[model samples]
Target: MISKKAIQIFSVGIIAPLTLQSCQQNAVTNSGDADTLTGRLVITGSSTVAPLVSEIGKQFEGENPNVRIDVQTGGSSRGISDVRNGIADIGMVSRGITPEDDDLSFHSIAQDGVGIIIHQDNPVDSLSDEQVKQIFTGEISNWQEVGGEDAPITVVNKAEGRSTLELFLDYFALSNSQIKPSVVIGDNQQGIKTVEGNLFAIGYVSIGTAEFSVSNNVPIKLLPLNGVMANGDNVANGSFPLSRPLNLVTNGEEDLLTQAFINYSQSAEVHDLIKKQDFVPLSR
Candidate 1:
């Protein structure tokens, strides 16, 4: 049996979004009165970062009592747009900002290893980067060609606007290559579920989501990239082909809440949380 203290810590630490809206509202109201700062903080971006941000928001609200952090799951592009338009305070992304997003300050809070995933029953254990490029670019249509069970390959992809999709395309030099129209587009969870349910399907997801999927006994396996496994050590060493920075974009000019959150993110407490969430914390 789990100890009460352990269970409590787990509840507060891992089971996220700790309180409902009513309690949140009260906490916000009290904190606003005490700090004399009041407003809802909007954070939009990568569903990959959603759970982490949401957990942070819960903890931040618990501390501040006044600021309400509203988190949303739009793709990275939309998140950037929201911040640029002053609709959001922070934009979370699994990829770096483009040249056009020069005005907003980009803070990389963590690193994520993107993994090529397939159903567990699928015989393939690993893939070279070139083979991955071929598979995603529509060059390889049969699983047998890549040492997998004989079946037509079904490529599941994140939506076009997603940072994961953009990163994979750019990484593989497939930016100009046309993807077959049949590519299934979905969010991270859906992408994992689709691949888990279909033996012939292949997809990519962040390490955080992959961990969650595997924890839940989802029938999916993370394929190594160019023989290097997708893990924190490989990601930190730059051996993982799909490793990318996860960022929290803010206005360069620091504000109270923004600075507070940034400081908190670098704290030891949150660093452990980042690790528990299966992301590589940014080096101090």
Candidate 2:
């Protein structure tokens, strides 16, 4: 039997919004009082980072009692845009900020790796980076070419605006226009489900997301990249080649509430929350 504490962790920590893709909407609510550390926090960005951020907000709200955090996700692009355009308090981005994003401050809250996933029964256990690149770019369309069955490969790709998609393309040095996909998904779970349901399908997603699904008996397997497995242990140890920072971006000048939340997100208390979401916490 699971204790209430463990169950609570599973509720907000592992599940909650971890598998959700948010609408193009902003939410606002107030908690506590203005006299205290109370304010409305509008968080918008990457669906991958939204779940962890949401969990942190839940714990922070429990402790502070005066802060309300409104978490929303469209993609990593939206998170960056929301911060730049002054529409949100903090933007949840799963990739490192490039030179183009010079206006906001980058605060890394966790680390995660992108994993190439296939159906569990696919028999193919791994893929070389070159093979992955070719498969996604439409150069290799048959599973047999990569030591799998004779079925034609069905590519499951992420939608535009997703940081996961951007990091994947950047790591492989491919452009969006160069790739052809049979299906496009918005979040990690969608991609997982698509691949799980189709034996011939293949997709890349957050390793944390994939691991969580696998733990729950999801019919998917993560294919190693360049002979390295996509797991949090490897990612945390810096052995995983496809790891990316899960960041929270704020304006160079931020408010008191925003600052507190950022600090709380990086606190030791939130480390379990990060792990529960299948992400690696910063070394304590």
Candidate 3:
């Protein structure tokens, strides 16, 4: 069933306070028709956060005709790198920024959880935390070992530089080297597609993304983590164990357009946009 819970969630581990109000007065007016805002903004990073941000960007553009927003996705690390290197005006990061990353400013727009996913036909409904760890580590190589059909488990892992991979490694007490992956995917959709195409494949992705895909009739199942159901409600309520903040990042004091766009993304105006993407939006 689709979750009825509001996806709005408070951002945890904020490195700095976000400036919500846009400084339109201080902004340099673009040379244009003189009535509409005009400028180009580039945002890049986390595939998980890209779609929601893109939707928000479209709305912002409609309100300000000449303003163009370009959204790109690689991984959270790429978002950090591009913003820090001044290539992108803003970056999308799916995980929280720690003190070690104090150089850049973080603006949290939403929250999400990472959950295990498998083919819909897989008979194994659940696995113990230890079993999940063992399976990824290659200690349990076959589905039969976990009460499923007798077939070798094809592990799907996220590629390096993706926050999902880092969070999964941390939660499972593992290093990337410990995993025996049959395939390495770049984003949530890719991971979902990988598992959907292979009945014995197991993977992980944003619970919000998984929920959205499942609602769209995607042939994949989000396995329960431990005993908790993996759904948007659990993620919004903080019951899900592996939730992370979805953030927009800026390296330093941003230009007027960048600041305005970031402010709009975090504002209550975009809550529905976040909800449509199945991510928890920032609370009032």
Q: TM per model?
A: 0.84, 0.87, 0.87
- Give stretches of model 3 more than 4 Å off: 1-36
| lDDT, residue 42, model 2 | 75
Better of 1 and 3 by lDDT: 3
Q: Summarize candidate 3's per-residue lDDT along 38-93 as a digit string, tens digits.
A: 66666767889988887888788888876766676677887788777666778899
Worst ten-residue run, lDDT, model 1? 1-10
Q: Give the residue spans of candidate 1 off by over 4 A.
A: 1-38
Give per-residue CA lDDT, model 2, range 1-284, as digits (tens).
21222111123322334322232232333445544676557787788888898878888878867556777777788777767777777888999979998878999999999999999999898889999999999999999999999989999998887888888999999999988999988888789989989999999999999999999999999988888888989999999999899999987877677777898898898999999999999975
Q: How many residue pairs of model 2 clash at the backbone?
A: 0
lDDT of 3: 0.82
Count backbone overlaps in model 1.
1
Q: What are the lDDT scores of the predictions, listed in order?
A: 0.72, 0.82, 0.82
lDDT of 1 by residue, 75-132 (tens): 7876677677666677787897789878888888789888888899999998888887
lDDT of 3 at 57: 80
Model 3 residue 5 CA deviation in Å: 36
Name the regions of candidate 2 deviating beyond 4 angstroms: 1-35
